[model samples]
Target: MNKLSLTRRAFVTSASAFGLVGASGLALPYYSRANQRPAFTHGVQSGDVDATSGMVWTRTDRPARVMYEVSTTESFADAVRLAPLDTSPASDYTVKRLLTDLAADQDIFYRMTAADLSDINAVSEPIVGRFRTAPASKRDVRFAWSGDTAGQGWGIDETGMKIYSTIAKHTPDFFLHSGDTIYADGAMKDEVDLPGGGKWKNVVMIDGKRKVAETLDEYRDQWKYNMMDKHVLALSAICPTFYQWDDHEVVNNWSDSKDLTTDNRYTEKSIPVLAARAARAFHE
Candidate 1:
């Protein structure tokens, strides 16, 4: 990929930059791309960070070659560009890489821009995320961990997942997702009445979360639905997350000895087959 001649500020602030920023200096989610240019579907993510390396990830709307650069400064005055990577149907258009040779105990800013493989000249608006590499010497370290998201019909509501926003407030170096990265087996209704007079409502109802996941695409949608929450997206943008899974990633109390014959919610009655599809979505 050619070195980006345009500065980050000039690129994002440009009038044709797809309204990445408005007069309020804040950006909009799912910013309209009526022109159908390739887009970064989900927000950027980083994880598995160490003293000198970290993993950065993102996904595109279509097959594209994503180019990225790393810098110690947000302005990218001293950026280190890496070889571009191509996203395809096999990987669900998601791309991630391990960034090595980074300075320890320093802020690392990573930026990504994708060019549609079908239309190489049509590029995407650049997206940026930051993470601090581990310290080379003895020093203080901070982090966060979470699990069981949108479980038991407690989906994202109008207030959003406030816990994620609370966790981001501390600006942890990274986050550990202990398990249940997604509640694929927990089908959520539009709303559930509380024990008292209040109502717990799902601000957005996705078809994937409406039933237990059985197909590969449905499992993928389960993950996407969780990221739809504003708080979840905000935390992921700047904080790296190391993921682990639990039974809920496939089904409640799932195991080799488990049987799905009694459960008719899934058309695929084989637990192994269901687990395979869920595993692929989780990995992606």
Candidate 2:
């Protein structure tokens, strides 16, 4: 892989847009002088912000060295290249880095290229991310808590929409999402079985054939799909988030020893090792 070299002044003058490759996976439209379609794909995102710096992330499926353009606006026409970072398979083609010298309580815009040689195949959609430098003392801090965001019916739970919307309106300093933040395997309760089916199918397979969330990919997919909801995105974008999880993210009431019996009794068949891996991936 080639190391990316970037200059603040030059990047601002040459690139046409601003974006990043981060957790949000945001993508904005791009225009080119070429007659061919743009090749850049995948959205951009930023995370882990603080007073002096924050981490920016991006995703790319293209097979090549991808370079990201960081800026404060969609039009890189007047932006600066914070750094020319490289992407690799180890991190799932997602690029992340810490940025500095930005103002607090302000939004940042960024974009990326699949490679210097390849066409800027896709540009990440613009994201207005805020950086709130932590207060000197913790005594006067204000924060809120939320949790149990689960299921994916087109990336959102109607119940979650109402709750987060109401929460965002209040403007808290931060949010703590409690457990079960995502339910990877819980499908829509069978209101009525489909004509061709006896019951709904579980999302994943467990213990070789148990059909439950049992792998890291399966678990991450659950989080990715569910978090894609606009309301969820909006809440995270606007307020700093500190999150946690519960059994539904893996299996219902997953525990060790004893009969593992409870009112909402599940088979206790969850693979502990796999469940731990899934939890770690999501927490990251």
Candidate 3:
């Protein structure tokens, strides 16, 4: 396997687009799922595709060396293995790699595995994703775009982000998330009263989602909670999502002049400081 020498700049550039379960097979809310073996806690994703290149991303439960392979077929019989990339606490155990020299306008199957840095034998079961590269010549191209996910206290319920599945039905080349990807300031309750004599239940509510995000980990949780949805995970695996951020990624109506004096949930009221924290979480 040939290792690609990655620069810090490259990793920062790829963090905007970000995956599924492997080995543990415990599904999502990976926070509760722990074991000695490394697991692909989040699924795999591919995006930022061009005629001959694209980006792929995934996250693990702990420090590990993530390996990669790409195939034109789903069975992966002709998979070309690439050298592993080490991930650690520095990146919160998340990593993305840019793949180049791919054939234009073709179906690409990517497979990934993780070997615990501390125990190489404790490797993970593979996870896979599919994407198509841009065409070299003129052709019909399709893509989807949307934003404002898991916001306004509405969260993943039993229905599980049905709209994402609807988007995947079109089989777009990629997805553009326009912004407000996570409502970090919007707190959630386990249940919301409905006007129609029923209750909107948030079946899985983590502590991070219970209140407004103030800490860096809390902000990160906002993204993690959205990915816990099956539909989001499904779309992510098959289509690359290019992410953008709005004020919500930091705080509501965030700006250099934004105010937090009236808000009591935050102990640190400095907009500059808070926005800086949010920016890091957004990049990751």
Candidate 4:
């Protein structure tokens, strides 16, 4: 592969950053295109397990590489770098590493730092999760299902909070996000940069200005934004999440052959049908 070089000035110009700052006081850029300096972006994920190995995934939306450290403790005071990984926009600015020879049924701690600089603030909040290795056999798993989190960007709403609380008390192993997890196209206060609320409007994008989302990236961003809610984040951390999609996951109502401008007749029926499909995907 070829390496791309970029200057710091040209980099921050396109970081397209977001998210709250931590005690570290770093400008964490959540996403960016190629040729931009990654504004302190990272994510921690664990999956694909066997007895002795599992995968650790992280990414950066910046123009440079990132180094990751995995450990068995939150402080990473005793952690070790499995290896250095290159980051780029092609993989959504992330990397997946296969860590081998780890003990089964034990918790592991993981954190990521950029390749060029060490910013403790940029480090993730110590993602410590257990390694299950593999299921012994077919077994019953209990979890909760909720959706239709229709609200604006940047949050959890009253109804959404209540449902999440209900799930917590039930104490299922995990939760299934059945569908309609976010109203990406719905207008809200944040949508119009108002103080409180805004009404739903057709997804729009203006030239030289931010556009209302009507594409896959916009829909994904809606999910990320919604999950930022403290309540939502707590629930996610407490339990594994199974997710699916609905029209609102991408638009208000859509189907295989219908456009956003399609008639209401098609929308009314297709929405449910597409909703079912999204649910099934979540299940699978």
lDDT of each: 0.82, 0.51, 0.78, 0.47
lDDT at 259, model 2: 47
lDDT of 4: 0.47
- Return the candidate ranking by lDDT, descending: 1, 3, 2, 4
What is the model-wide C-alpha lDDT for candidate 1? Answer: 0.82
In the range 128-156, model 1's lDDT, one tens digit per residue, is 99998888899778999989888899998
Where does candidate 3 stray beyond 4 Å? Answer: 1-35, 256-260, 264-269
Best by TM-score: 1
| Candidate 4 per-residue lDDT over residues 1-284, each given as its tens digit | 11111223322222222123444665554443333334433234455554456666544545334554555565666555534456565544556666665654434555545532232224322344333333345566556788776454433433345566667666555567777766655544423344566543313222211334444344445444554444565564445455566666545546555575444423565555544533332221
Q: CA shift at 128, candidate 1, in angstroms?
A: 0.6
> Worst 10-residue stretch by lDDT in candidate 4?
1-10
- The number of clashing residue pairs in each candidate reads 0, 30, 4, 9
Q: Write the per-residue lDDT of candidate 3 for residues 4-118, one digit (tens) a residue.
A: 2233343322211112333555423333223667888768777788888899988899898787777787878766666578898887788988887777888888888787776
* Inter-residue clash pairs, candidate 1: none
lDDT of 3 at 235: 94
RMSD in Å for model 1? 8.0
lDDT of 3 at 223: 77
lDDT of 3: 0.78
Q: Rank the candidates by TM-score, best first.
A: 1, 3, 2, 4
